[model samples]
Target chain A: MIRAEKIFKNFGDQAVLKGIDFTFEAGKTNLVIGKSGSGKTVLLKILVGLFQPTSGNIWYSDINLVSADKESLRKLRMEVGMLFQGNALFDSMTIEENIRFPLDMFTTKTLKEKKDRVNYCLERVSLEGNNNKFPSEISGGMQKRVGIARAIVLNPKYLFCDEPNSGLDPQTSITIDELILNITKDNKITTIINTHDMNSVMEIGENICLLDKGKLAWQGSKDEVLISKNEVLHDFIFASPFLQKLIENSK
Target chain B: MNLNLFYHFGNFVIWQAQIFKRPENGSMYYKETVRQMYDIGIGSLPIVFLISIFIGAVTAVQFYYQMAGSLIPAYYIGYIVRDMTIIELAPTITCLVLAGKVGSNMAAEIGGMRQKEHIDAMEIMGVNTSAYLILPKLIASLLMIPILVCAAALIGILGAYIASVPAGLFSSAEFIKGVRSFFIPYNVIMMLVKAFVFAYILTGVSCYQGYFVKGGSIELGQASTRAVVYSNILILLADYIIALILTA
Candidate 1:
């Protein structure tokens, strides 16, 4: 479980995340949705402790991330796995090395043990023989799959993904969303995904928090979100003509 | 200009220092340093040696030509090679060669990592980016470079001799005498010390440039350029400082 209280973030004088608050429950996918520059990425970074919040505190379970020291941050980090927007796999290393990197850095596993675990994760992601291949040798979707494998390789207590479906085709994006949902349920790990994909929201969002211009517009399940007549939330949800027509037709 | 250059300098130093502060980071940092030394120091030996030798030989040939009409002896070629290798080629030219090779490699590696946001990833993973990345490299350069310089001086003098012997100047004995006649023990020691300083400067400056780089691949290229540029300038400046100290 994770909670953010009154998180304020700024880039110089430009406020990005302005006094936002939300809590993510364990054993489910918590989706943070916002348009570009709506402070989704800023909030995600604060949650992961990548960027210091201008003012606020983030709690992972009971530990206050804002006041945590280096050791505490490191322990949280070890328990956390992040799937970056671009995969961010080490270009110089092969897939196996990339997947096993957290193990190498944080675990006391022998090389043989690490290799076995890497193979297991690679197999779980349906990427068995591809371990020998470099990042360039793989397709975009495959790379994303590898990124997912790397994220869950540590069997982390928490997973954070930033724009995981950013550049993929719709079908592939849905597949990724399903994969994430399956993984979240399978591992029973608290997962937070920062996304703008409405399809993903409709498909796999167990919990959804909408942000608008550095403020939390709404926080609830998809069912609640669909019935809520909050004009701001409706504007965001029905911004596209296709979705607007769907909402009108549903009524 | 009141640009606060010292503060910037101190900040950079502190950033570098912070990398070496963590206990969990030590093994990797040490391993990286060893790998770098192997790459920068051991891998570079052949090139540095070949150049030193060629320079030594040419210096002897040039000495033969210059001293031809003079009262100076033929074995003076040895003296020329020895002085040039100890004072200039071993420390200065060796450092320059390494800057092109290892310094550039350091910049490119760290620069590429920066471009990929690997450093940010490391930080988010709660690893001290500096300790995991920079300390290994700096220590590697420091430990291995002086050994390389010593090789450069020794091989370079031999190369000079190999060239001179064919010219019918200085029988082996006479050449040996020429090298020793004006040999100052301190000069050899000075070259070693200078090479160590050069190694540290090259590694530190290159890594620093790469670490703070913004933007993407183009910015990494810029960091590499800055690494080479700043490293070259510093090497020359350090040479003068070493010279001033030795002479004084």
Candidate 2:
């Protein structure tokens, strides 16, 4: 339900995203994967109205996010939920308050209703009893879970996750990926995730777009990603010799 | 890594205007003001009081060395204390205190939140992040700092009295007369206005610094330090301008 057309973004002398085009389908995980500084975060920010594209357009079902008004952006934003890379929980707030923030700002729900929804979101992320905990008191993995819970608390139609696996350990990364996949399936929400985690692509990425230096290098699912003989894609997916050898052995 | 100070100043104007435009937003501004007073004024009372009292006592002792037993009227000590505290110490030093306490805090909190993208989260949730964040600070400063300075002034005068009365420096009635002799209602109003202006300097510049903090926690910390230093300088400049106006 999201389409970006010929989007171009630059920072001074550096062209970050150049002439990129993509469409995201509803009810599936659409991932944009790349190395560091590959413009994944910028592209995500553009789609979510945090940054304006230097050129081209992003359509969120019809309205161009790059040029939307404040009120319209706010309206569109209400339908979108973002899980930032750092979890971004307000330090002044408890876990429950963090989860309930969107509800407090966007919904007129009664206190009881808001609390129930918070509890539900917390349970969904396996954080049911940690309502009163501050962010500094929580584990990094738990914080990521809290981030996911906050992202979905508003029952948003669109979900965007940026580097969801950045600081998590390998095992926790997989669990978080699985949690994202399960949530996407259950809610049937249009989900987009930005990551460099190859395992996440293989595990939960139903639709994948690989970006290399602001250019779209490959677009496919797990099956296609594995079987493709494209050299650039191969180098990207198996840049590390260990993974390359492991994938060769698996093949 | 990019910072445009003017753009941030523009953001401040827009945020403040929006908060004042809507009634609910305005009420929220006042409510946030009260909350900030508890944080900035009430919480910091002990330090502010003790500092002023000690400063007044020390000053009275020091000034007595020059004019204690000579031709100068002993009760003039109260007048000197009143003039100094109201003119220089209350507005400027109080702002300096705030620069350390609330100024850095506002920058850090908002900058920290900005780094976390909590500000963006607030924006996406249909809340006016600027109004919710900065307006409260602006209003709080306007409402609370005057009271804080007034309290500081009262404590200063009392401390000066305590320090002087034991030495047969001045009778209480005579000191009261000296303080009242040249009382200017306009001066008090001018001092209050100056305090309000200083509050804005402390809160506004700090909020602007915090709101634009990019990168991560490290950048936010940098923003906090910059906010305090920059706003401290600005508060002094504001002090000079207000002094020019009131004394003109």
Candidate 1, residue A83: the lDDT equals 87
Candidate 2 lDDT over B196-229, as tens digits, reads 8888788888988898777877788889999999
Best by DockQ: 1
lDDT measured at residue B245 in model 2 versus the true structure, 0 to 100: 80
Check candidate 1 and list the clashing pairs: B19-B130, B19-B131, B56-B160, B57-B160
First chain TM-score, candidate 1: 0.96
Instruction: Report the lDDT of model 1 for residue B23.
Output: 48
- Tell me candidate 2's TM-score on chain B: 0.87
Which runs of model 1 end up more than 4 angstroms from their true locations?
Answer: A241-251, B1-4, B23-31, B168-173
- Runs in model 2 deviating more than 4 A are A247-251, B1-33, B215-221
Indicate the worst ten consecutive residues by lDDT in candidate 2 chain A. Answer: A100-109
Q: List, residue by residue over A48-80, the lDDT tens digit for candidate 2.
A: 877888999998888888888866776887788
For residues B118-185, write the lDDT of model 1, one tens digit per residue: 77677766667777778788777888888889888889888877887766766888788888878888
Q: What are the candidates' individual DockQ scores? A: 0.55, 0.52
